[model samples]
Target: MMPQLRTLTMMRGTRARILRKICRNCPNLTTLQLHGCQKMNYSLLKYIFEKCPKIEKLIIANNLLADRQYAELVSRLEHLQSLEVFENRRGAGPVVLRFLAATCSKLREINLSCDYHPLEDVEYFVKAKRDTLTSATVRWTMAGKRPGCLPLLQKLDLPHATDLPDDAVVTISRGCPPLRHLSLTFATSLTDGALAEIHRLKHLQILDLSGCSGLGGSAVAHVAQLAALCTLLLQYIDDLTELQPSLRHVLDLKQLRCLDILYSGHIRAVAFEEFSVRLVNLRELHVTYEEEDEVFYKNVFAEMQSQMPRLRIINTFRWTENDFLTDYETDDDDDTDIGY
Candidate 1:
C-alpha cells in the first residue's frame, strides 16, 4: 500500500476491482485522472470519492456517468478545485450545474467542452461561481442571453463555438473585465464588429482566433489595440487579405511574443519579412504555405531568423490536434496554484 502517493492516473482498461484496491491504498491522493477508463461506474466512483477525501483535481473525460450520477459523485468531493469531465453519456444539465454552484464552493476551474448542455445552465453556474472561477471551457449553443459579470474570471475558452454572435462578444467583454486569456477558436461567424468588442479586454494576453473566416485586415487592426497581448493565433482565417497595410498596426504591440498564421495564404513574404523585423520581443512564429510558395517563405523566414537570432520559426504542417490539447491541459493544471 502506497499511503504516501499524491497523484494517480488510470488511463484505460483498469478493472473495477483493481481500481478499488488502488483507491483504498492511496487515501492521501490529491490528483486523480481516470480519462478514457471505460470500467468506471457509480458505486466505484462513490467509493473512490469517499476514499480519496483530499482530491483537489479530478479528470474523468470520456466516462459513462449520467447527469444525476455525475452531480452526486462530484458533490461528495468537497475539496475538489479543478474538474474536467468531457464527453459523458448524458451531458450535465441544471441538476449538475446547480449542484456545482450551490455545493462546490471551492471549485475554480472546469472544462465541459464536447458535452451537450444548454448555454443558459452554464451561464447560471458561472454567475453563481463568478467570484471563485478563474478559468472555464464550455460549448456555446446560442440558447442563453448575455451572462452576468464575472469580475475574477481570467481565462474563457469557447473552442469551436460556431453559434457565438457579435452581441455575445460585446456582453462577454463587458462582463469579464479582468480577462487575461480568451480563445474563440473556429467561431467563424465573428466579424470585425466582434473584434472591436474583444479589444475592450485590455488585459488580454493570449488570444486565439483560429478559423474565424469572416474577419479581414480590420480584425488585426482591432487586435493591435490589446497592448498586453503576448500570443496571437490567426490560423485558417481565409479572408484576412491586404495584410501588409495592417502589419504596421500590429507593430504597436511591443509585448507580442508568439504569432500563429497557419493557412492564412494572403500574407506575402515581403509583408511577413517587414513585420518580423520590428517585433524584437517575438520568440515563436507559426506559418503554413502551399508547396509552390514554400521556397519563398523559407528564404524569408531564414533571413528573419538569422537577423533576429532569438526567433523560432515553426511550420504548422508539422503540428497535430494533440499539441493543442496538451497545451490547454497544461494550462488547466497550472491554474491549480491559484488560491481559493
Candidate 2:
C-alpha cells in the first residue's frame, strides 16, 4: 500500500525513520528533497534510484560530500527535472554541475551560486534537439569568462565578472536573448560600450548593477531605455554626474517598482527631489541622506503615498556607523532590561 503513495518526505525533522521506510518500500514516490541533514548519504540516494523508477524533481542542496560521491550520485539520478547541487567551495560546483548535466536528461532549472569562480566555461545542459529549460542562476568568482549558448533559457542571474573584457561581455550578451531579469554585480570590466549590447535585450524586466563602479552615465541612460524594467538595484556606483542622463530615460518606465541606491554618497539632494517627482511608479526607494536633509526623506515618503500606493517597503533612512552603533546599543539596552 505504501508503494502507491507519492510526494512524501520533505521539510520535517522527525520523519527520518518514516521516509527511510517509505523509500525502502514505495515505488510511486518521485519528488525528494533532503537538505541540511547530517545522517543522510549516497546510500539513501542509491535506494531511491534503485526502488523509485519515476523521479521528476531531486534537490540535495547544501549536503556536504566528496567530489567522487557527488559524481556517483549525479550518474545514478538519471530522471531528474530540477537539480540543485550547491557546494561550499568554488570549484566543486562546476565539477558537480558538469557531471549532472552529462547524466540528467530532463532538467528544467538549476542553481549553482556557491561556486566561487569567474565566468568559466559554461556547462551547456540544454539538449540540441529541444528542451524545457527556463530558469537558471550561476554565481562565480572571476576565474575566467567565455561565450555560452543556452537555447531555451528565460531567466538568468550571473555574478559580477570584473575580469571579463568587452569581448567576453559581448559573447554572453549575444548568447542570451530576450531575458526577463538580469544582474551583473561587480562586473568591473564592463564599460559604457557593454551597455549598448544590453539595450538589444528589449524583454528585460529587472536590472541590478550594485557593484558596477565603472558604469558611466551613458550606460545608465542606455539601460533606462528598457521600458519593461520594474526593479533597479544600484549600490556603490560612484559615478553621479552620469545619473541625470540615465534618469532622463527612467521617466518613461511606467512599470518601475523598486529602487535601491545604497552608499552612493555622490547623489545630491537635487537628484532625489527630481527623482521623487519623476519616479511616480516607484513603490520603494532607498538612498543616502545628509544629516541636514533628514526631514527630506519623510516629506518624499508622504508625497509618494498618493501616487506610489504599492510602496510598502521604504528605506529613506541614511546608513551611518553611528546609526549602526546606536541600533546595537538599543538592542543591548533591551537585552539588559530583560535581565538576560
Candidate 3:
C-alpha cells in the first residue's frame, strides 16, 4: 500500500528492530540520512546497508555510532558515490578510511567532519589511494601530507582542520596535481612557503586563506600568480599589516569574480584605483574596517562604481559587521583542511 520510496530520513528514536523492518521494504532506497540520533545500533546500520544495496548517498550526522559501526559503513556501502559523516565521537579513523579506499572504488565525493581531531586518522584518509576522488570536504580534522598520489582530484575544501604546515601544502600539490578549488581558512601556521607551493596549482580557480594569522602581505604575492583564480577570500586575517601594497601584485588576476576582505580587521584601507582599475571582471566585493576607514571604503566604492559599474559591493553603505558564515574549531599547527 505504501509508495516505493527512494529516500528515508529519521532524526531520533530510530530503533534497531524498527529500522530492520523498515529497510526490508525499501529495497529501492538510494539515500539515507540519520540526523541527531543518539543511538545508532550496529545491527540496524548493517541491516539497512545489506538490504538496501543500491544506496548512492548516505549522511550520518550528530549521532553516536561506534568505531566498528563506522567501519561497517565504509565496508558495506560499496555502491555509494557520496558519503557524509559527522564523527563527533572520533570513530572515523585510519583503519576505517583505508578500508573505504580499498572497497569504495566508485566513490567520488566525501565530506568528513570530526571532533577532538585525530591527525593520523585523517592523514590516512587523505593519503589513501582512492582513484576516483574529485571533491573532498574536511572539518576539525588534523590531516597530514600525502603518502601517495591523486591525479584526478579537482576540488578540496578544508576550512579548519588544524596542524597543516607548508610542507603539507606542497605534498598535496604534488599528490593531487589537478586541484582547482582550495580553502584553508584560519590555517595560521602557513607561511609564504605554503603560498610558494600554491603557485604549482596552475589550474586553481578559488582560494580562501582567511584568518591565517601567521602570513604576511609579502607572502600573499604568490596568490596573484595564480592566473586562473576567479574567487579569492582573505577575510579576518589578523597579521596583514602590509595588505595595501600587496594588492598591486594581484592586479594580473583579471579573471577574479569575487573578493572578500570584510573582517580582515588589520587592514586599514585599500585604494580603489590600485585594485578596481585592473579587476575588470570583478562582480562581488566584501570589505570591513575601523570607524576611521569607513569613509575611506565608501569613497573608494563610489569612485569604483563610476569607473567599473558592474562591481557589486556587499554591506557597503550601511555597514553591519557579520561573522564568517562558517568558522570552525581548530588548534595551532601547520597544514590544510577539508570536511564533508
User: Largest lDDT belongs to which candidate?
Assistant: 1
Q: Which candidate do you rate higher for lDDT, 2 or 3?
A: 3
TM-score top scorer: 1
lDDT agreement with native, every candidate: 0.77, 0.62, 0.70
Report the error of model 3 at residue 223, Å. Answer: 0.9
Candidate 1, 25-83: lDDT as tens digits: 99999998886735666788889899999999988753343357766778778789988
List the candidate 2 regions with Cα displacement exceeding 4 Å: 1-33, 48-58, 61-79, 89-94, 116-133, 139-145, 238-242, 266-281, 286-292, 324-340
Per-residue CA lDDT of model 3 for 200-304, tens digit only, reads 888999898887777766665778888899998988774346554665566778898998886666554444576666888999888766665677767767888
lDDT of 2 by residue, 74-146 (tens): 5665666765655534333335444455566677777656543223433443332125666766663444433
Q: When superposed on Cα atoms, how far off is each prediction in RMSD?
A: 10.3, 5.3, 9.0
lDDT score, residue 155, model 2? 75
TM-score of each: 0.83, 0.73, 0.73
Error of 3 at 241 (Å): 3.4
- Poorest lDDT segment (10 consecutive residues) of candidate 2: 121-130
Model 2 whole-model lDDT (C-alpha atoms): 0.62
lDDT of 1 at 61: 54
Show pairs that collide, candidate 1: none
